[model samples]
Target: MKNEGMERLGKDELSAKDSYYINVMRGLSILRVVLVHLGLSWFYPPYSQYIGIFLPVLFFVSGAVSYYSFLRAQSVGEYLVKRLVLVLVPFYVFAALVLLITVVFYPERFPSGIGVVSWLLVWPNFSDVFFPLNQVWFINCLVVMILISGPIFFITKKRPWLLWGVIIFSLVVSLLNVPFPLYAAVSEYSFFSRLRWGHQAWQVLVLLGLFICGSVHYRYLAGQSAKKYALISIVFLIFALMGYFYSDLGFELKEHAKQRSLYYLFLSFFAIYFLLALERPILRILARMRSLEWLLLYTNRYAYSVYLSHTLVLFYVEQWLGLTDLGGQPFLALVRMFLVLVITLAVAKPLGDLSRTLAHTVRAKLLNGIIGGVRT
Candidate 1:
């Protein structure tokens, strides 16, 4: 029993090498996310088509990390509190700051009087308006996924086949084009219709499936031999290429749009496998470049902040500098993307540092106060 307990602990703990590779992948994903939001329509083909792979990879990494986090947490309440502070607090802080800027400068972009109050009281919907806060839908969805992850982890652990079963069921539901009244009702209420339980069922289901896939990959595949991973990776890469070039089946499935088509699901799986296979070789090359390695690590550390804040920076850049006019020109688009990335990193890094400090201080104070009260 003691040996088994030790083995379990070993399995749950991620090695430094594995962690480093995952962080690099996260940095790459965040970069792709910024590019996608930059409104570079011409950038989507050939190279950017590969960017679609990043979302599933991100979801997978999140699942793996969340599972480890769950194991370390003393209780579900503690796990939730940490997630709320780490994820939601930064999101709300950044969101409110963006909303304030819009209300003051771009008043027309934001809703008026009672509508503003209502939107704040409920969740801000990304679909309703062209607000900087729209990008935060990812964070909102993540929060929802984390809330339910404990049950998911248990189910996946006890009945691995059940996880695949759920995935198939979700895929079938997506194909059926099932109508949801609750989705329609809430969608009318706010742009954040995806946050409505009934509206985003298929999306959440697919994400959960992806999340499970990530957990399983980290647990099982991460330790495999290079030749084995390479072989698997090649197979998935071929399938992904075939889907992208030959068929539009998965092209319609976009997470941001809350559409999880069957083709997109397969595409995401293939992309993930290809990425995992490349991790070892990529890390070896990155290790040789000390400066570039550090940069990626730093970016990954503050990726969430970068993700939340980049759109706002991009919006202002476009408004002030007229970057949108150069949209179709490839060179200008590359320049614009570079500028947005640099400016966003500058703003997001400082904001992330400040938010982390504030969150830590607040959490410490609250815990101390509670302990003092108990003593009293």
Candidate 2:
């Protein structure tokens, strides 16, 4: 953590009401993430395009929130434990249920080999390691960020020049034309081929860079006027539009997203700032509409569990119903996605409510035990 003087930013901390706006973004991000995971057809042109920036937005807001949390934390251990519990506990429960359902009901889809299980217990990325739980990558990535964010906070506070250097380096990594690392190390047929890089490699650097940017935003730019962010976002919007309309420019976020290209980087910046600018107006509109506001808040509140668990629901529902992407038909895709969405929401709400109760009652002791005696 930084000095008290740096930690305490008068009127700059994210108030509860201020954070509700953030939750708006969170709700939207996870919803789109789920839609993308539903395996919509490519014929839905620019369908995936809308999703490119959500992940970046997730990382950005996470970094911003992390700054506030880090400053408020009583100890580094506590900070780490709280964040870890929020992510890992729900995921563990979801994974166990997935395993039970897959093994007991659809044994054919159940994986073979203890080695793969080991990877799922730790990494849990894709079919290379686990099946249908590929959505877990974001959870794993968040854990990685939480593990390193403390050091990042300190670096940015005490040695900002060094942090900036790392940021610049990571931006380069994101913008590079190089293929994802570990592609050659593992068999091309294995899921590891799609893995970004080693612990210190590939998209991790770019993600960390954005995480740091969020922290910096919380630290230095939290209470700024909306016009400032709006103006900046407009510049990014123009460049992004240029890339979209003029293919020769190579600026399309959708095109560059999987590659993590330079164009995608600009698009990410544009999205983060654009949302910040709209926060106030959005909040106001929600305030006037009680039912819609409640729905959005509910989604935001339970998004963590829903986001993690929806893919499982999608897979199993499809399995039981014998549903497939039949000829990549858009109507079928939409119907399937809609069913999964409804089911996931119905299931996640009660679970999230129960989790909140547990969090209020025994979460302290539970998390403390897991963290080797850390008190939160």
Per-residue lDDT tens digits of candidate 1, residues 1-376?
Answer: 2344344435767767778788998887787788778753335554455456557778888877887776666555555656556776566567667678767876777766654553543346454346455555566567778888766666565454455665566555544433443324433455544335445444565567777666666655566666676687677666555544443444433432355544565567776777777877788888798777776777788888888878777777787787787645778767778888889888877778878887787667755665576579
lDDT score for candidate 1 against the true structure: 0.65
TM-score of each: 0.79, 0.79
Instruction: Give the TM-score comparing model 2 with the true structure, all chains together.
Output: 0.79
- The residue pairs that clash in candidate 1, if any, are 125-191, 125-192, 128-191, 250-264
Candidate 1 lDDT trough over 10 residues, lowest sum: 177-186
The positional error of residue 6 in candidate 1, measured at the CA in angstroms, is: 11
How does each model score on lDDT?
0.65, 0.67
Best by lDDT: 2
Model 2 per-residue lDDT tens digits across residues 341-368 = 8898899987777666655445588555
Q: Identify the runs in model 2 with alpha carbons over 4 angstroms from their true place.
A: 1-13, 39-43, 46-48, 108-122, 128-131, 158-166, 175-200, 238-255, 320-323, 326-334, 354-363, 366-376
